[model samples]
Target chain A: MNTTVHEYRTGWKRALIETKISLTTPGDLMGFVMPTAIAIVVLLFMQGAEFEGAPVSLGAMNMPSLIGMNIVFGGITAMVGALAMDRTTGTLLRAKSMPGGMTGYLVGHLVSTAMFIAVTVIALLAVGLPLFDGLEFGTPDRWLMFLAVLVTGIVAALPIGAVLGALLDNPRNMGLVVFPIMGLVAVSGIFYPITALPGWLQAVGQVFPVYWMGLGMRHALLPDAAAAVEVGGSWRTATMFAVLALWAVASMALAPRLLRRMSRRESGSAVAARRADMQRDW
Target chain B: MGHPRPHDGPAIAVADLRMRYGDKDVLTGLDLEIEPGGVTALLGPNGAGKTTTIEILEGFRGRSGGRVSVLGVDPAHGDERWRARLGVVLQEWRDNGKWKVRDIVAHFAEYYKPYTDPWNADDLLDLVGLTAQGGQRVRTLSGGQRRRLDVALGIIGRPALLFLDEPTTGFDPHARREFHELIHRLTDLDGTTILLTTHDLDEAEKLAERILILAGGRIIADGSPDQLARAASTTAEVKWIQDGRLQIHATEDATDFVRKLLATDDGAVTDLEVHRASLEDAYLELVAQFEAGEAAAAVDTFQEATR
Candidate 1:
């Protein structure tokens, strides 16, 4: 890599570590940790449910898909919130002017988001496996299924989060955008299977990526159980990954352009004009 | 005024520097050279392009037209090496308010190439009289304290050239005096060249060896404070008590008249006071003249356009 890229990546890693440790307030701590915990608790609680082809219990339900939705709410939503604040406060502009600026900034945000999600998922899993008596993963295939789902879900969620962050300049607006998507992911098959929803609602949920992502996860985590349901098909995993890969690639490509445009709007005179008005009012 | 001292080189030089916004000109064919290791005060009111000029020099804004050089490099293309030599304290700022004072300073230090050690950051806090509160969160500090921290951070890297934009806008009289001493010490002890922009005339008079007055996006006057005072109106006010009554004389030859009065045993010449001119007075007079000239030019342009 070039010197700029290397330096930015290094800076980004440091920024991430700093952000994770800087959490002080009770509200902030909960904001990061609660969603992951809730997802795990709800997943384990709904273990013995009836599906179209089989009577599923905690021992046979998909664990990886539940974890994916947890990452979406806890990791991606938090990333958007933090970046929106950075943009509003002029910290991002300062980062642009400094050496290895944008590379470092984006890297820092991504690393922090990933780290938090990993920690939250692990913590929830540790508590979940013991509390949910019926849930078990003794086989190697089940473990491989969980890994594939985890990797695919995180990759899919990241670009959507970045796109939301880049477009919404205000944290309030970002919250408005995030909560609805998060709600859709949560209520869809991410926690409980979409088959539980009303017909029209299930149709609506199917249009979203979360439904496909959850379906893909079920195939990986509980392949035999998933096979019994008509929803499991060769096309489901292939199609979900294809569409998600497109989103991830497109969003990553578009993020820098969006960020550059925003930075240009935040050029020196723009800041000066704002300060001049503040001075006048003062 | 001190004699122009011999210099190793000009610290800053701008040749035919031009910057435009849309069709309007912010800086028009501007040219300037500042000597190394002294405070050069840029004096101008709002909308005079003072901020624009400083931002361009600091490498924050790109120039539309001109060859501008600062610390021997064009700011537009200056690399990390050049940035290492520059310390800029802009009017706008963003501190993670949650971070402690010392933490903020330490973080900025990492961005510089060859900054002073940890002690220098501590010493700066003491220098700015914020040593006791070094551990306090920045959000807890007052506006003046935060501004002082801004200065301390600006100088922490021991930059060869420092740009301060209205550094003492909200400082009280005592704090302003102390900040002036801090700025003086930066040059005297470290040989750091400083270019400061300010609306406060008293600050410019107290801090700068050379002051440049800008009006309507162009420099109207440039000289030492005393020279600007003299170059303003040549008229002087001659006041004296004559026959127990106050008498005032406005004349160009006030000195000669005062000498003549002294030559005689004129007890009536009691309370003799001759007021020549001052920097504030000179600045006001120059602004008035510039406005009149602009008004006349506008009328001529309007008539020509009509024809």
Candidate 2:
């Protein structure tokens, strides 16, 4: 086999090993389970509270939104966190020392991130299906749409996460990523309706991938009448896909250049310096 | 043992290499060369740019100026093929903490499959004396064990040249000796050109065929261990007790001075001792002089005095 192909194969193997390790590690496993647990508890608490002018209860409306928000969280935060931690730990330098190692390292992360999102999404649906009413997964089209939106959502968010990860020097500064994501979640209508927010806030939310991801999930899993609470009383499937695709293109275009720059700066001394800094912080 | 490849070119050659960090020059007009299959040690105090020079040769950092070639290719433009032929054991490695020793080593070996036949992970682990620790997590290994693993990873590709940057910094004496024995085994097994950097004079003497003393960003001294010791032993100190009084004298010729003292003392001299300047003393003096802001003068003086 060609060297590049072999390296990519090695990356896939790395992804498999890392995925297994993550699943077995209690802390990593809990990272996936805790959010789903919190979402479920939140969904239960909101049960029987009806939304104004919408046909479904608040719990039902939130089920799909929570799933949507989880995708963005899992895709973006996971990618960013992995890059920053690996860079600090000398994994990036180790990769650079080997032939075609960078390609393997990157492909491994991409695979693992995708798998993490898939597992999280499945877990949420399995738990949500038994507890929530008015969810529409009975048809093939709904399942297909849900799958498409989930995949596209991850694809759109990953490159943005990569860009952020490359730009940040310290993993301790993850609050910079977390705070904006929380704010985005609020404006993106993960818990309520975007129309309830100010017009400008709604416009701002629509400009990001978080809002489109949530809207896409609602269109896939919620009852048709649930569209009444949306901005224009329509699914806006075409617009949602267009916006998400555009974000994916823009981020993908920029991420490689930024990631290359970041990787190029990694050397043994850089890693050693980071280790010393971490010791001082501790 | 693998057969040594026929290559007439030097394993590493650098000319007028310069590195400036921000406004300060770390290395200025440094030059050195290492013959194939020869173990060379770069000895220097902290912040003497040893790490910078090694990193540039490993192609991990770009130099501000000058030419550097390792394995007959300029490091700045070295391709993956060039990278495959080189092994770098960095100063510190805390990566793969969650990975098992065997798994990490096996994973690394895969990268060399397309370039060259790599050592088997199991055999490599045993060679590094980590067979019992293969199942252990890397984070659980002691500092010495981790360094052994680092060496294993560095040589797994059967590299033509290996770079070990202060490989025994935190090792205990026992571990340090064992590590030295392992290096000797590697050199004997195959003619792998090894270039290591260290601040320890004894380690350089023990492991390297040639020692390059780098101070103030220049090669101030270069020779084998015996030659270095001889070059620095230009002065000797003699101590003796005569008529219940202690006497000490410094001289350029201890043998002649002792001969005259013994002849003139009429058998009164007792508790006599002669101490030749050790390499450690010379190394310390050279470093002290460089640190005292007379690096160029110190280099010139040492070279002139030694010659």
Candidate 3:
């Protein structure tokens, strides 16, 4: 097999094309913009509320938290949904038909998703830096730290999404993933500090990547003294990266086996049958 | 990049292919072979294992026991290099609905670039007669247009062999005719071999140089459409009024039978009718007899009629 770099280049090109189309399309543009718009509106509303005797307004704190949440939370749900939808629509089978198409598809999806997350986060920052008090990014260290957290958070989320996608055969059952994440968000403390929750709720939040992602973002962009209100009374940056790293490693290990199993079962007739079932479900 | 494809063997070769799902056998020791570069249609009623057989050939499904090869490599072990030499078009395709027609062609064209010289997107669109809809999103295309696009995508890589599974199942006559013309045009593309499966006997007769009728998990009939249609039965039944009484007889030649009947009746015969057994009637009757029981008898019946 004389597989070449051209296949990956093609995949990257697919991502670029797909991203451009989504940005231009009305329905897809809403998905990209609506969440960030809502986040900005919420930040404007909470600009005055102080959080647990911290110098930062609740809105300033919530900005980084929302960005973090979007990475880990939105990444998983969106990937799971995209995979299930693609299976029913025969896109997966179409990919399998080509020589290096599967690799191109996956590389395209991951890069495009990262591009979308970056765009949403940038939109949040564009509004956050000027409108909110107590948010910091002037120094080189802060910028590097923010970029690191964002990259680590994305690495932690993409494989988990791929695994969930392989497990859930029906997109309708996406509520299985959504409902649990909704419950997790309440405890992960996107709108406030996790230290304010019950000790047990704080521990539950810490167990998943969602809470750690929030903490990493806070460590990156929030004032260092703001960590006084956190669970350990400081930015536990090492533990946060360590935990997210473990999540990434574990999921990356499992994702390939499951995704391979899923791809093996894909065929033209199989896709047609699954699509027929999906229509009946509708 | 300079590797030359080996093209000396039959395009497809299969031996004793078997597929078993739990206790049920879908394919029982089936065998087949096709020399490269001609259209062959696989005709079978439902549940005759046509899908199973085709899927196995496409390397999309595994078989219980068999040796199968396409393009000189065993399909079970066919690699990307092997895959690049074949094309597949299925029954339905609504994927990539968000992409423009030309963009989809362009994107997939990229996938084949590392392996071979694929068709240019515009030229392929023109070949499939979809140049007018190149700018439109795929979801807006009508059903026939969509199938044409599927064909365009399938053969974009300039594959040596193309598998078309029931290409015109729900097509209206005009649409089917245009699709058939497009299929005919495809034959000029440097010895591209096509294997299509359908239940439409007329379509099989129209498009295929050879037809294989798969029934009872094996191909019982294989020949040109003319031969298969002629094999079913060769006699016509004649009915007439003779001396105010109805007379009926069966003969191989309807004209000769009618001539004899009228002459023997001495100018009293009237209201004559000749009912030759139709190709469709033979096919449907064969299916009906197979459904009635005695799997062995179905083939026996056709053979006896032919004899």
Candidate 4:
């Protein structure tokens, strides 16, 4: 009988429905699995290489790092793309017309995106475990750390994505966010150790969620001795979680304001204008 | 529900509604009122701000200045409970492409559960004529079928007031006819107050019980379809053959003219036809009259004539 209880329960159902949709729909399924497949291909090429005095092959080191990259892409870039697509398709305006529909919609996306990232990261780990010899994910404590890192990574990434998604009305402008993330991954040492990058680039990398999550994942799965090749020559575990938690807090505080502003401006004419611009631009 | 039924005043009341876009003024001192039931078609030329007016009422857009009340709540301040009482279907929508038709309907119906009992999803789909296409994905439906789905989603919450912006755009004759019947069924089921905007006068005449023709950002004619037709143009055109030649004449009194023609030249008149101006003609005349710098006089005259 309570309104908030009913709305949130419906939101939970929506998330389940959307998760099924993403799993079955070809375009959506491809968006989720394509990055993992590419990571496998890239790791295949790195199988023979090893970092100096590191405990595992370069491929094993890069495996969990790539999982971090998935969290960023699935949580940030993909979320932004979904928001932009929904705007052009009038889905957002449709939600605006319904009572408590916006609340349901936001909760649904958050839950569904988290599930997709979970599925993607698990798939990558399953595929990587047999291929890499030194992955330390078998221990119970390692699993706990994996769950912790993934949760904090999503918390850090999704809100920033929502904030950016609210700001970019045009889907064409999505490239503005995607390319920068791609550039950040390069400097963030997803495919290489942060110690190999220039000190300034490593410094730039350490400030963002992507590099911190990669470090957290490495701390979770890679043999602890592999920390010799990391920036601090030991897993700076506290700093990793603290940095991600800080990003999550900052983004969480700012996202709702931006999202409300964005939803307030959503009307039929606004959707029509965006569609018209898309057709013209395309 | 915090919002009890409020029917004493007009369902929608707008006074001095004004909208401006940068340098252009779309609506200037526009005022309107609609009672609780029946369909009212808002007719206006493009850029006359029919969409703007409807959006303002739907609480999707904020007005520059006006006193607007929809369902006894100012739309600018209309809350979630206020939104729960209204339904809106815009001209075009391509949403939820991956969701099945019936699934989407049943899914959206859940959002209204906090405020009101929603329509049964199966019955709603049948009413909107999407029963056969229930299992089909939304993106696969034809244009008419898609619009019917749009209507189904709009009213799933059993809204007391519904706003349809050009409900039937780009519909073939057959589809348009079916859509009109569905609209009739909706209004008859509950006295759901509906305000629709459309460019098709025939559709307006057929679906709406009352028609308000807006020109120059104001309602120039407001009455039933027949009244506006009669108010704007009373002169009927008469065509007849006399002495084996065709003759055409316009007269304010067609019955008298025809009687005189038959009395004076009964043998010579072989073919005769009388044509009264239709709603389309009256609509064009009113817009033209308003554009030629004599709108106030023309509208006043039509108001007097209609009265």
Candidate 5:
């Protein structure tokens, strides 16, 4: 008998590429891209509108709002949704059993989520450039600020996404997560200005990372005049980066422990029973 | 049977393995030994703890209590090297369903070191009779074809020990035959040790060198197919013709009886025949015995309590 020796060799790039290509599924394209597209177009029309007291051209606001939406709905939400679906389907357990599997697979997912967020950002930019006529996209330092916000937002949101995925164990529970976060998005100046809200509501909005991410992007995209009226000045941009970074660090630290705990509860029979039950019911 | 000396032998040795789910125990002090080479069929009905034992051996599930050694290492603490030595085809996989056939196969290739270059995933496609659909999405493939893909992925790593969980459950007759041939080729050519579980008795009879039947989380019987078929306690059903009319008999020694009957009757025996017992009959008989034993034990306990 040769009794061959075996070793686990994982190609990170290949894994990442495979993960990216899988994002073309219909549910993902429809659920993620459609809403962002609608938000952008609506903001474009709203930019040209004259409100009751003032003429508010929200066209410029579209970029920041879309960016904010991308962080919550696109980056974080999709990451959590994907992992949750994998757990529900037994894919995560199956992968974890393979050699060098979990690390390779998760690295792939992170890359894929980052790539998707980048693509969504580019698509939103392309749509924004053509839709609003008075919009003059500049070589403003705003791009740096937007990139900073996006990176921090995605990194921070990933741990929370992973924790939710680990804790929820199913996609429907993830839906519960989506509604509340969407509620946060609605109140957090993504659709309209949070500044227009009452004091208590504005305080509630500030507590969420989504609001800070949007505020940071707005400082980068909107002209100094509009940004000053909303968030004081460039000083708030640093604060946004620091706070979001802290959340990211905290969530990342907590994710693995939560994942391990959840894994402890998983058994082949129980999973099999759950799947059988799901098939019978659904 | 004499116990074989433990001389750094056997690819897998499991003893006193026990597992529980809530109040019900799935595996109750079960034991198993798998030697290297050929296939060992893990046979059991639903909820029989066949999956539990296999999962624990594969390091995918934790056993509540037991000592298990696979390839000289305890599976509970086995590392990536241990996992790489084995290939597992699970009951279901849905992650790569969205990927194209070629991409999915090629991508999995990177997960193993010293893996042979994908030798005609198309040729394999042809072997599994999936050539016409090689480029199609896996999700679009029929259940049998997808199962063939699962087999393909399992063997892609060229594992030393391959774990197959009902590999042909959804397969039609033709696909099942093809899959059997594929399995035979793997063992013959590469000398891969395969541990498989199946509800299909025919599959066990055709493929396995040794078979283990599990019931109520215990190994009720384990031997070669013929040895199990002729297990001392199990009866052999026999049938033969005595005159122009047909005659049927059930006995432990059909061959001996047939010879004696032929000698006494001279040329009276028209259709001298003896039907060979099958694994299915032996299996059903064993399960029945186990169930009856449990019932009797329960009644005995009741009687003792009343007295």
Candidate 6:
């Protein structure tokens, strides 16, 4: 096999091993489970309430939005967190030492991140489907649309995560990303409809992937009449796909260049310096 | 598993190498050459630019100005094929903490498969004396064990040239000894040139065939262990008891002095002892002089004395 091809094959193996480790390790497993459990609890509480002027329960309305929000969280935060931690710990330098090792390291993370997002989405839906009513999972079209939204959502968010991961020097500064993401979540209407928010806030939310991703999920799982609460009283499936595809294209263009620059700056001294900083902080 | 190189020049050659970290010169016109198949130690005090020099040669860092060739390729533009022929053991590695020793080794070994046959993970583990700990998490390993694992990864590709940066900084005596033995084993392999940096003079004496003492941005001393000791103008101290009186004398020739004293004493000399200057003593003096801002005088003095 060609060298790059072989490296990518090894990357897939790395992904498999990492996924197995994450699934088997208690702490890692809990990271996936805890959020799902909390979301399910929230859904149960909202099951009794109904959205104003909408036919579905509030729980049904929030379920798909939560799934969309989880996709963005899993794709973006997981990528950024993994890259920053690996760079801090000298894993990036280790990869730089070997032939074609950087390729393997990156491909491995992409695979693992995709798997993580998929597993989280599946787990959330599996637990939420039986406990909630008015969820539109009974038909093949719903499942297919759900799969499309899931894949497209990850593709849109992951490269941006990679760019953020590459730009940040200190893992401790990861909190810098969290606040903005939470703000985006609040404006993007993960818990409620953006239609009820200020017009400018709705416009601002529309400009980001988080809102569009939530909109895509809502289109897939919510009943057709539920579109009454969305902008223009329509699903706007074409607009959602176009905006997400644009984000994916723009991020994919920028991520590799930024990632390459970051990898070039990796060395043993850089790692040692970061380690020293971490020690001082602690 | 050795791959024939396209060229047969020295394993490493550097000339007029310079490294400046924002106007402060860490290495000023540093030069070195290493032949194949033996261990060479770059001995220096901390902040002597040892790590900078090694990292430049490893292609991990770009230099300010220099000419450096490792395995007949300039590291700045070295391709993956060029990289596959070299092994680098970093000073400290805290990566893959969640990985098992065997698994991590196996994963690294896979990267070398396209270039050459790599050491079997199990065999490499045994070679590094980590066979019993292969199943354990890497973060749980002791410091010494982790260093040994680092060595295992460095040699997994059967690299023609290996670079170790301070291989045993925090090792206890027994672990240091074992690490030294492992290095010796690596040198026994066919045509593997090893360059290691350390601040420990005793380690340099024990493991290296040639020693280069780097100080103040240059190599102040270069020779074998005994030659380095002799190159420094450090005399041995001779102690003896003659006619119920203690006598102590410092002399350049302890053997001749002891012989003459014994001949004159006529069985009266007692409690005679000779203490020659060890390599550690020579290193401490050279570093002290360099740090005291007499770097040029220290180098000239050593070179003059040795010549």
Among all candidates shown, the one with the greatest lDDT: 2
Clash pairs detected, candidate 5:
A47-A57, A47-A58, A47-A59, A156-A248
Q: With candidate 5 superimposed using the best TM-score fit, by how many Å does residue B123's alpha carbon deviate from the native?
A: 6.9
Q: How well is each residue in A157-247 modelled by candidate 1, as lDDT tens digits?
A: 6666777777776655765877698678755666556666777888787666676666665565454545455344342666767766776
**What TM-score does chain A of each model score against the native chain A?**
0.79, 0.98, 0.96, 0.98, 0.87, 0.98
Give the 10-residue window scoring lowest on summed lDDT in candidate 6 chain B.
B298-307
Q: List ranges where model 2 is wrong by over 4 Å.
A: B1-7, B239-249, B256-272, B288-307
Error of 6 at B155 (Å): 1.1
Model 4, residue A43: C-alpha shift (Å) = 0.6
For candidate 2, write residues A1-282 as lDDT tens digits. 487889899999888878877877888989889877987898898987988988888898889988888888778888889888887888888889988888888888888888878887898898898798888899999999999999999898888899899998778778899899999999998899999999999999998989899999999999999999999998899999999999999999999999889888999999988878877998
Q: What is the DockQ of candidate 4?
A: 0.74
Highest DockQ among the candidates is held by which one? 4
Better of 3 and 4 by DockQ: 4
Docking class of 3: medium
- A1-282, model 5: which lDDT tens digit per residue? 111222212435644665566566777667767777677767767776532322236666656666766775666777778777776666666566656666666766777777777776777767776765444457756677767777888887777777777777666566688888888887787767776788888889888788887877666666665653464434376678888888888888988898777665654555666677667767
Of candidates 3 and 2, the better by lDDT: 2
* Candidate order, DockQ descending: 4, 6, 3, 2, 5, 1
Interface RMSD of each: 6.9, 2.8, 2.0, 1.3, 7.3, 1.6
Cα misplacement distance, residue A112 of candidate 1 (Å): 1.8
Each model's lDDT comes to: 0.67, 0.88, 0.85, 0.87, 0.69, 0.87
**TM-score list, all predictions:** 0.79, 0.95, 0.94, 0.94, 0.86, 0.94
lDDT at B277 for candidate 4?
70
For every candidate, what share of the true interface contacts is present? 0.19, 0.72, 0.66, 0.84, 0.45, 0.67
DockQ for each model: 0.28, 0.59, 0.60, 0.74, 0.41, 0.64
The TM-score, computed over Cα atoms with residue i paired to residue i, of candidate 4 is: 0.94
* Residue A131 shift from truth in candidate 5, angstroms: 3.1
Candidate 5 yields a Cα-based lDDT of 0.69
| lDDT rank order | 2, 6, 4, 3, 5, 1
The TM-score of candidate 3 is: 0.94
Candidate 2 chain B: 10-residue stretch with minimal lDDT? B1-10
